[model samples]
Target: MFEALYQYQGQLLQGLTTTLIVAFGSFVVGFLIAAVLAPAAVYGNLLTRRIIMGYVGLIRGLPELLVIFLIFYGGTVLLTKLAGRYVEVDALTAGIASLSVVSAAYLTEILRSALLSVAQGQWEAALSLGFRRPRAFLLVVLQQMMVKALPGLTNQWLVILKESALVSVIGLEELMRKSVVAAGATHQPLAFYLAAAGFYVIITGISTLLLKAYETRLTPHMR
Candidate 1:
């Protein structure tokens, strides 16, 4: 077990890098979409709110694995048809896109709640200061919403980290896939599996600590 891991340390590192790339890429993309849609769902007209909420609901209702499969295979088919040639979505692209969809849905709800938690007076105060709605929200409301949403966002990121393992099914040699191959090759499933678990724990632990520190720094008033 240890022997195999030690021998394949370089490959494992590459796998970890791939995992991080997928997780962080999706997280950022999802946050950007959520930052826009969350506000629309909260402040837009009935039709717009309905449309945003409906999307959120639909994405949340489906399983994450199913979403990955759809995006991976369906995207390939769609692209192939459009191009009139064989086109396939690589595992990394599909993984990021699918997870981004999943992340955006949850992030929207988290941000919507955070935005609501902000006092209406904050908006009024910004307006009184001669700030336009967009400027007010960006400068004032967004900061507070982020502070309020930090814990949820941290957890959501961890969720994304774990969900990235599902991408292995599509043949991306991410950490989980690498671990599986190592286990099979070494005939030491338990050792490699536990090692993989430890790797996940270490990454998630470090992320949680960093995010918490940032959260504390952002909300010093709460301290």
Candidate 2:
């Protein structure tokens, strides 16, 4: 067992690197979309909020695999038609785009709740201090929201990380794909599956620990 693992160590590392790259890429893009759209969903006018709400509802209603297929193949077709040429959409791009859209929906809800959780008095106080609406939001409300939603956001990130493995269906060669390939080659499905599980556990463990450390660091300012 040990020798087998050692022999495939480089392959496993490559797969792990691919997994992390896809996860982090999706997270960054998703977080940006969430940061902008989440706040807008909470604070925008009725029409704006309604449109964003529709998007959130649509994304949430669809299956993740369906979304991945739509983005991967559909996007390629659309892009090709638009460009009047063949356009390639790879697994990584599709995974990132699908994950970003799906995660943004959840992030919007998390942030909306976080924004609403802010005491009304905080806003009133900011206004009392002669801060304009924008300034007040930027200076006071946003700060509190970040701290309040950090945990929820971290949880969403973990979900994104796990969901990224689904991109293997499109031939992304991520950890899951690597495990499947190894299992097929070695005829040791249990061993490869267990190894994949261990990898996931390690990734999630490290992510959880890092988030906890961040929360601790922010505790002083939270109060």
By TM-score, the best candidate is 1
lDDT per residue as tens, model 2, 1-223: 6666667778878989999998898888877887898878887999999999999899999998999999999999999999999997988888888888888888888888899999999999999999999999999998888889999999988998899889999999988898889878777778878888999999999999999888878777654
- Residue 52 accuracy (lDDT) in model 1: 95
TM-score of 2: 0.94
Lowest lDDT 10-residue stretch of candidate 2: 1-10
Candidate 1 C-alpha lDDT tens digits along 1-223 = 5678798788778889999999999999999999999999998999999999999999999999999999999999999999999999988999999999999999999999999999999999999999999899999998999999999999999999999999999999999999889888889888878888999999999999999999999989889
lDDT of each: 0.95, 0.88
Where model 1 places Cα greater than 4 Å from the true spot, the runs are: none
User: What residue pairs clash in candidate 1, if any at all?
Assistant: none
**Regions more than 4 Å wrong, model 2:** 221-223
